[model samples]
Target: MKSPAPTTNRRNGSFGHRSTPEHLGYSPTSGHNSSKVSRRNPMAATVMSVIGIFTACFTPPDTNNSKSFVDSEEFKSSSVASEASRSGSHKARGSSRGVSITLHNSIQGEPAIVKFTMEEIFQVTRNFSPSFKIGQGGFGAVYKAKLLNGTVVAVKRAKKSVNEKHLGVEFQSEVQTLSRVEHLNLVKFYGYLEQEDERIIVVEYVPNGTLREHLDCNHGSILDLASRLDIAIDVAHAITYLHMYIDRPLIHRDIKSSNILITEKLRAKVTDFGFSRQAPDIDSGMTHVSTQVKGTAGYLDPEYLRTYQLTEKSDVYSFGVLLVELVTGRRPIEPKFELKERITAKWAMQRFIEGEAISVLDPKLDQTAANSLALEKILELALQCLAPQRQNRPNMKRCAEILWTIRKHYRELSASEFRSFSTSSQRSASTKE
Candidate 1:
């Protein structure tokens, strides 16, 4: 049996009430513990369409021909050459490889961000040694760096020539979003450095591997049902924080298991904001932000994919796929499986609706009563999140609340079963005596 998972404590009002506010387009419905979502106003759809057209017409072409980040290169400047040529002297020297600078805590009550010199970066990463390399993503390479003060941080080095156009904007967007948000379940940003031809982001180092690695058994230990539940709650809380608590609501365009970093204690922290976008303000009468689709292939929202409209519900859709992935122990896309079973979420949902919910669960997990109950409830919630229409999906807050309730019921069922077994065992002992 897997060891017990550490319980995560919720703040006084962080989880919010069981009932979501009606103003946020969520209201309790009669059956199946589902909620009603209000559709986007007609005006909002018209505005979104206009915005999409404008973006399509005005946005510059992506001239960087490399298909993937790993193969990407800094393209020669043409019409955009003016932006690169403004600084003439810095171009010839290339990378100032041996320069290092000192950074002091300049902010009150917070660690002020100062640029890490190229020399300091080289020392910590051993000149981006293969062994020091931890992971790679759409942005660039990530290395584990240990500072002189005994502080360890994850140094994310942007792909070379990231300062040119779209990639440059993405780098800045991630830095700005990371600097603004702070939450236990969200990776904390320490600082950022943008020197000539080098762009790096430093954040808190999460030691344990990603949730995907654990799910794939690359970490050599099976994650228990209780731990998975906690992870789900942790991610939901993080997304809820981004959606509602932050100064500006944000959409985590990429919320896949790979982006969810696990700590030593099995807690999850959401990372990688390269594709994150500020959500449209509902109060300001904007219904959805028009942006190009950005997310993992299997986890992208169907509505967002079709309309070029982005919203918080897009994140909710990905979360639903994640929940299914959690319980099934399968990737969102299982290409090697049988044709009908290729799409994990659809296959699992079919099993769920067909009254074989337990059949879709991960075979590694024990089929105990509590596990069965939690499985059913989680699938029910996942179905809501995977709804075809954004209006049919519940908000992130509701998802967190539902998971909280499910956890409570699971614990209660487990305790009840334990007590029953204990009493029965006592009776058997006395009779044997």
Candidate 2:
């Protein structure tokens, strides 16, 4: 018989109030347990959709283990053309043949010759000085560097030393996976340099910082309802692209707000692939190859954690938690709340069923003036995504479609309200005349 999994200390306080398998109306003996099966009911679906809409508006907390520090100095640019010439032609290198380097653009579906030297990168990033630093993550520090061509880029430099076997494996896996996949939602990799003891990846610089920064800084007030919906749609679209449009489905194990970066136009781009993995074939009944339990605390999939099996549905589960943070503007795990009451999804879902969804809305949102019914629908979607069972969560495509539908509905309602106001004003003017 397989041994029971060892328990890690539950973070974000104790597991919130347990919804007994019986209370949710499922039999524990039914192979997969009650919580897993209970999420498939139509009622649960309705609740999830409603919660999902509202939850998509809130900001996700920063759970990244890396620390971001700023540098006071500016980076000096070096001519890329000169550097390319110094490195010698790709043809020459290929003929000489050491480790053949081929550059390919995954998103554009094309290949190009790439030649960059370590010296050029160093000059661009000011030797990875603290001043140019933008952020740091579990993988490495991100520095804002300007190339000689006047192009600004974000350079990710891996941690100085990784002795742990798991961490080293994860680093190599990310480098291998991200180097090949390309999508608009994903951060673009210009190229990478692997040295004896260090690795660095060059990518496009997203100026607006992370979605979490915007949400937390403004307390969600700056993001009006429409803007919030747009962000949700953008992120959903990116995830949909990853799951369906890519040659091989990729699962972003860590799908929190921090991973979602905002461009200058406030467009959402899902970044960070350090914890991502490819999906396995469908007939194999495996979405991902079996691996160690790897993910953040609140956003981890309960099923995957228990089974030590990864899947695309794991991404869905994390997205659900993100949705909750969006709508309720609450952290996945709140230390201020009671140990058994800190889980956002469980508490919020219970309140939703009790028809007290207004209390769950972010105080920053003007729900009284907004369409309360629509918000409720979004909440329902979030609940469904957070379902304990992987099969119960909606696919990323469906989730994006649902969010798009909500956006359309809001536009129609706004148009109607404008028409009504115009008609009323015209009538009052005629009366005055």
Candidate 3:
């Protein structure tokens, strides 16, 4: 006999009502819906425990062993089975909580679906050592960790010491939202661990660090024009994925240079979903009970800040600010600036629109030829993205495509010049001979 559905309720002290798939306006595709499932079901508890045991057993005997084991079929099969079991168990639990749990496969592989145990996470992170600490944010601390198999990973451990009531809800939201999301430009979530008082998320470790760091560092040669354009395209693609590709449109309430991580190859990936939310069409103009007015102050959408109504366009505005950062290499907010001229995007765009693009290009790039026309084109795109009206901004996909096209055009122009120079040199050589 099929098990009875579990009860559904927002976790302890959850402010909003449990969101249904229908309410979110997305039909259940995975046969299970997370919104319909309860986290308190016995079967789910049992499965979680079982999976934890398996993880403990199968975890590489050492970090080196774990890396080797990850490539083996045994690891893949175990991970798949564990994930399927977790989803099934979650569905059974959901019946009790009145929430639906939907299971979906990630394109990168099913490994992202597997859930880790708190014990395993702690073991992997070496007890969140100070030496391993990579960065800290409003919600948690990021640690650089190496699993038994030698694969480096970034572990985001929620601040458990903070009141559990707040952390619990955020933890659930992040796990449910990030588990199924898979895109090349977005950061990959390997798995998560939820214990009584602690929660942790494992993601791919990006070695190149944050965009903010590169901008601040003395590394002048690192962020050349090509590199800047490439990062912009990648970040735009990631935003596009959240805005359009997902069934429920997500608003990355916070989008800043610090949130954009880069890899060794300089590929950019957007990270930190702690403040992200699925924009509900029904509550188009209403304010929800979010924990706080959360967002990096400089990147926050003025309209959103005023109306308390979050939307995908909020992200667009923030992205526009990022574009300005890339072009001018200026901080979003500078106390040194006059109070009225603090926000950089509006300031830079206004200057560019007035045909003063040369004045706004970062002084670091002063030696480089200033293409007023090309800068104007990029500024125009930024203006559209930063439009005060939500309807006026281009979506992320279009934004990325446009930036890519600009880069391609610039490359072609340079290539043609190079070819012309080579041909001229060959002709001169022949005449001399």
Which candidate leads the pack in TM-score?
1
Best by lDDT: 1
lDDT of 2 by residue, 202-266 (tens): 76676666666666764343655676677787778777666655545567777877777776566
Candidates ranked by TM-score: 1, 2, 3
| Residues 1-433, model 1: lDDT tens digits | 1111222222124445654443445342222332212113322242233223321211232336332211121111000001122123322312221234444343432223345677778887789898977777657788887776666778888887624777777777777677667677888665677776788887767678788888888889999999999999999989998888755678988888888888888988888787888888676678999876666767777677666789999999899989999999998878799977877887777666656788999988999988988898898778778777788788888888888888988898989999999999999999999
Minimum summed lDDT over a 10-residue window in model 1 is located at 74-83
Who is ahead in lDDT, 1 or 3?
Answer: 1
lDDT of each: 0.70, 0.61, 0.58
lDDT measured at residue 290 in model 1 versus the true structure, 0 to 100: 85
Rank list by lDDT: 1, 2, 3
lDDT of 3: 0.58
Tens-place lDDT per residue, model 3, 1-433, is: 1111222221223111132111212111121111213222422332233222221221232333222111100000000001122234434523432212233344333222446666667677677779988777656777887766565677877775646765666566666556646666677666676656677777767666678777766444547666777889888877876765554556767778877876666667777676667654433443332323446655665555544556777788788778888878888777698854466765675555444666777676533332333354466567666655566566666677667666776566557667887999999999999
For each candidate, what TM-score against the reference? 0.77, 0.72, 0.68
Q: How close is candidate 2 to the true structure, as a TM-score?
A: 0.72
Candidate 2, which segments miss by more than 4 Å at Cα? 1-115, 162-164, 218-221, 283-288, 338-341, 368-370, 421-433
Selected candidate, larger lDDT, 1 vs 2: 1
